[model samples]
Target: MTPSTEMFDPATATIAIVTFNRSNLLSRLLESIERMDPKPGHIVVVDNASVDDTTEVVESFRERLAPSQLVYRRLETNTGGSGGFSEGMRVAYELGSTWIWLMDDDVEVIPDGLAKMGRWAPRFKSIQGRRYDYDGSEFYWQYRIAERMGIPIPFAPAGFDESGYKPMNSGCFEGMFIHRDVVREIGLPDPRFFIYWDDQLYGWLASRKTQSVIVDEFVLRRTREIKQWDMGIRHLNASSNAYRYYIMRNRAIIKRYYRALGVYNPVLFGLGTFMTFCKELIRLIFVERTIRGTSNLLRGIRDGRKIANDRSWQPMPPLATTSGSAPR
Candidate 1:
């Protein structure tokens, strides 16, 4: 489908950045935002109980941006990235932003990125831009849900056609540009996820209402490597056990979400879960070489299965507020 060539006003867009500690990285990202040709109308920073000088960093930028444009919400507790984004999106929606651009503090938005999104955002419900590593290598992030298999498949991007946008089923908060209406429709991201798969599930829900796409335009450069594979596809970046827990546990939640939408295949989902467990087990044993981590992954899978069955698992509170910088 052809996107409208009409230009959209950048002022209608707001940027929502979720940060935890890493004051230096947050400052760098804020500085980059300041340089955008057409800066976002408002920038909401959700501080997830950072022990560092993150609040001080936010205060430093207050002098340059309007009071409303620079908002700082310090959570009383560390709500993880999922909760942080949920609150940030709610605030952005309440502020009457037409669109919300979400990202973490670990990346810097390219100067021309927001401008490009504004130009093309009018044609799609959700837009995701490309990302590169700190060393300037293109990060392979293209992924879609194989509906038949009920699992995500990472595919490499081909040359861009004049079509301008390619449909996508999964999304990441990094450089995610979504219309406010999608937020209203799908509701804010489920904070229960607390870290992983939340954005992907939300993106899938958004795709149900309208089109979502990934544009070839470069929008962000990843400053940190959370996960990476070595030669021969060996796991090189061994993430923390906590991360491993969430990565495995969240699969059940994702499956539940798909089931609610009446789009899930039980047999396929089971196969995918078994394959994931096996793959993680091998990576943990041979690549990471951590038996404890493997056990943690197994525990996560077990608990997640229970979580998926619990009918009383309600969503977390919508908003959490605190005064001053996060506790030390």
Candidate 2:
């Protein structure tokens, strides 16, 4: 069947998908995008050094998508989701998209998801307060304040409390729209974060520039094979090292950046980093049984201490690259 072009909007928006070897899931996600209410002006997919026939699969769907609605780029090396999305966002920005929609290959956008998200774009843009109040108790406190202040708290599209905004904390990359201006200001995801924490970092950094509101609408369904590593505890363990390194290093960097602005609070930053290190170290020993995990934990703690003490910001090298095919 020839795809309907009636609902497609060619004016101001584009959709970008970042994929790494998930051909079957990507096919489904593309089909779903084809059925959205206000069809995307452009659809660009980045194949992140997939060894599989993912490139061929996307090509096969070209005929099924509207002309100019589909474009695909292949990467020579696996650049992780952060790099892939960074490159994709850059391409979308250059394509004259006023707003770029970002998603993962495993997420299927609902029929009206894009339209719904577009409706809330103004709310996101008009946001007037801190993306997160660094001194506001805990993260939840900020959510509470946002709600009380008449700001829409972030929430999962469904199956989560609606009274508070919780940042997308998992691999749920669908339903996020990035304004061209925000991209212009914040640049792209930090390439140093080769894997885990990139999404959170994006939201955290972007929140500084644009208002990111979690709308109370289900926009996408993430579909992929369930792996043992995906279970709550195991998933945490799998990312423990990257988490330790980035959390320690980046927190210090952020704290130092604020300090230069006279918002300095070395005591708080140091205390927080130390507490986080101790907590993660305990988790490593009790939950994750690897000596490497323990060793990394200590290394992260030592590095965090140095950052906290010196109050100097230095970017670390990207985490060692791994073949995406490794078992999750």
Candidate 3:
């Protein structure tokens, strides 16, 4: 039998993209969407108040992808990727989307990619699709959470069998397909995260409510190219200082979630955080080839300590119980 509660109309699925000043990349993504066999019914672009030709680029595609209702919600302030996805998902939900596809502006959906993803919607409430790097190599995304550290660790069994799908707990916003019911239960991605670890926690929370899985279906191609430190099994992309900062600082935020879930052990998590820090530090020196933002990393740990110390911290309330700007 089909999913008894949720509907699965490929046309009614909404693709929620979070974009910034990358208009060229945005245009390419929109063009890819325009080519879908049965195009998504809605396209919600949450602009993080980009001060560029982003508006012009989005407006240009508005008419060409007609009847699909391309919406451009430019935020008053730059809320970063975390806020952008949270806002984008909220908007799609209010637009009556049964399944919301989330992604950044740097990728293009491959031919029939959406169809491959849609094929399993009736059986799963949350799904993650595979992606390709700029060179067409499979981007290694298989991950399982390191619960003690509240971080993602690469999983074993790199390849799947004939089933073409495998169970997963890690979440990558680039190609996560989730149902409205999941949102109703967990609310939006915490905007306060503002950057890093947001998708990991969001996907983890979604997994707690449903059988989340990552399929072998090739869904999209990365358009932007960045130098990565080849690590044999996977590649580590060099990141900006901002990425370095938020990623380090977000550890405390993750701790808050695990604590709320009653699976926290201070000693274990504390040890895991240090190991995680050391690992990322190696990545920086090896990939970026500099000891930049070392202070920022240390500062993040200090601030995270404060957050963990706070006794009043609370998780996002369920959307079914409250109302905020679902889309603005």
Candidate 4:
């Protein structure tokens, strides 16, 4: 079924936020949402397993807001970004919402964001048959190829405009709107992603199913700075190790699956994969320079290559929900 084409109603859209352990940021985001011109029908917050006092903070707001104004769920373990958003989307769907607005806790949606979405809804939906529907299928194939080759697909642009507002390559979860029908067709975020790159995967899937856009009218305020890891002992550390494991492992799986379908372009794919690995190696040797840097980088590269070459690798563990902690 397609999303309803009826008049836009704030009561039919549910705004969902996925948060980790950032209580301070979550509070700010909630405050911003509270100030929207047309208030959301419902605000659903899914807390990944957090050790912090996120539950207490959310409870404070629950006490103040009317029952219909807000809803919160705290998972038992950390489900990373994918799991949190998956659960949040499920909640939104169950609420009978026509649209779902997904955002990270660290992002503060502009006051008119929701209204702006309503304004552009018709324009987007109108293009469904002519542009959105046809292009979506083609875009998915292109995206799969790009991902396999390690090419960073620009998210915001979605190939719509040269305007610098490209939808992020994979992390649109920070601030994205989902039409109900899109979710019905595609289902939830792939839980295997756990954390990194989950947003890109979802955006790629949604881009095909409906008219998704990175609206110029609404901008989410990002509160944190992302630090790039250098090549060194730090790169070989636990956090870095886990990050490498997922990125390499997932990409390999994506590559092998496409190859089996005879859609793989080996030359481009190999070049892309080689370049990516080399870049990582350089980053370790020069940028990070930790004591175990080279060794860790090699290990990650080896594992990634094995997965890509053999086309057989064990899947990562299923994500678990963490206590409600604020995102950082």
Candidate 5:
């Protein structure tokens, strides 16, 4: 059936937010959500073991938003964004949501963002909304990548059409609205990723089976500064040791999955990897000027290579790693 012919209620969806040690931001996010014209049926907050007053903040919102409108799950340990999101999405799905909208605690939804997405939801299984910086400027997220190889094409932007829906190969978690059926098919985001590239992999999985697109609707305002240093050829963001490790280590996993699915390109992947290494090394040596940063990059690369080459590694099933509860 086509989306135009199907019936849907904006309130039937669940908005899942994964957060850690950011109560202030969470408060603002909840405030924004409270103002949504058609509020989501439920708001699932996956607290990644924050030692702060996150619980208290949630309780405060629960009082204002009503306990039934907000559900909180506090993890026993700190799972990075990947794990938090995995658990959050799982819980939201189990709560009988037809759609799950995933995001971090760092963004504020425009009052009508969900309303806008609701208008576009029926047409695509995976619908990604546009993002903007805190200054209200649109974020240029269209980086070019080898379509089949899944590697970035030099000096190119992903072909994005401003007029209509454009097919998406990958997307970020911020303002990403996905159907519950897609989760059942592809599984949850891998917690093993710990942080980087997990969303791209998840998006790729969705794109493989369903129509995924980046809609021109504005949904989120990123509160953080855009982070990127410079690749030898282009500027990218600098990162922490943990981010460096996962990014490098997880590339092999992404490559393996793409190849296993018959879309991997060795030449393109290899070239992308080489370029990434050079750019990161240069960032560490010149921009960052930290030996520790350099060490982390190299270590992450070494670990990533080992993971990529592992013969026994296999993808985990959806919900395989969830440490969260079903919605109430």
Candidate 6:
């Protein structure tokens, strides 16, 4: 199959950002984007109906991104990150964007980040860029998903510098650069997941049609400091209760996709889920110094099982040319 593809162009790449109530962070991100020497041809800001000054923040960038299309879409409700990205990507695609550069509002694009990522586009349909944490440390991002087990492959590369790119099946939306071809193949991201695990599955789907890799170029800077549990060898970010719930519940959503691919193993996936529970439990108890969110985590697993067992939950359909709506 001659892969359905498009020529890579930084100017025609649409920068898609999903922002909630974080107007402050969005402002900073917009400022960084404005500094890009070779700017994107379009920008799509998907606001999850934030009740803050997010609208104003987006408007402020209109003049800065002159002549370049700047679209600000405010959803009627807060659909979390998943729905936001889905809507944002659909809008970008409908606008005839060649490349959709997706990210959260919390990260600031480095001046040359888009350029560095653009270099890999002619060869790769899907690309991931390196990110620096708030503490200025390179984030651990390169890895592949164990589709059968529904987990990450253990002992993946921590970071890469010497190589131009490392083969990775997984993708981080915070700095994902993908051609519209992948979107045409895989469709917009699933929005059933209100938050967690959507990116991994979406990335996995993209890898099916094209070579997905993590480019060695630094592209983003995470602005907010997160609490980390130092394990002496490596540090792990602590999680919030909301994240814990979705992370636990979203396992079923992931399994749904795996099942479709004929790689889902009930026994192996059960073991993987067990391991995740144990790891998160330890993190909650020791790293967080509190088991307060234990109930939510357990509840999530229970809900996930129900979701998996339910017969009616369907996989996301391919995106329509003009509409981004799905059954609620």
Best by TM-score: 3
- What is the lDDT for 145 in model 4? 20
Global lDDT of model 6? 0.84
Off by over 4 Å in 2: 1-11, 126-174, 225-264, 275-292, 299-328
Among all windows of 10 consecutive residues in model 1, the one with the lowest summed lDDT is: 319-328
Q: Write the per-residue lDDT of candidate 2 for residues 1-328, one digit (tens) a residue.
A: 1111233243467788999988988889888877877777788898899988898888887877775468788999988777888778767777777667888787677687766666655445311111111122111212221211111223323333644333431222344666666666656665555554455545544565545555455566656532222233223333456666665555544454445435546566556556666656655655565446656656655664566578345432222223112111
| Candidate 5 Cα outliers beyond 4 Å, as residue runs | 1-4, 152-162, 226-235, 282-292, 318-328
Candidate lDDT scores, in order, read 0.78, 0.57, 0.85, 0.60, 0.77, 0.84
Backbone N/Cα/C clashes per model: 0, 2, 0, 30, 8, 0
Off by over 4 Å in 4: 1-5, 63-68, 125-150, 153-171, 228-241, 256-266, 279-328
TM-score of each: 0.88, 0.66, 0.94, 0.71, 0.87, 0.93
State residue 303's C-alpha deviation in candidate 4, in Å. 5.6
For residues 183-210, write the lDDT of model 3, one tens digit per residue. 8889999998899889999999988888
At residue 39, candidate 4 shows an lDDT of 75
lDDT of 4 at 54: 85
Alpha-carbon deviation at 101 in model 6, angstroms? 0.7
TM-score pick, better of 1 and 3: 3
lDDT, candidate 4, at 310: 66
RMSD (Cα, Å) for all candidates, in order, is 5.4, 10.8, 2.7, 9.2, 3.7, 3.4
For 50-115, candidate 1 gives per-residue lDDT tens digits of 999999899999877653378889999999999999888888887877788999999998888888
Question: How many residue pairs of model 1 clash at the backbone?
Answer: 0
Output the better candidate (5/6) by TM-score: 6
Error of 4 at 243 (Å): 2.7
What lDDT tens digits, residue by residue, belong to model 6 across residues 59-172? Answer: 988998866779999999999999999998988888787788999999999998888877777778788988898989887764687766777775676666686778787777
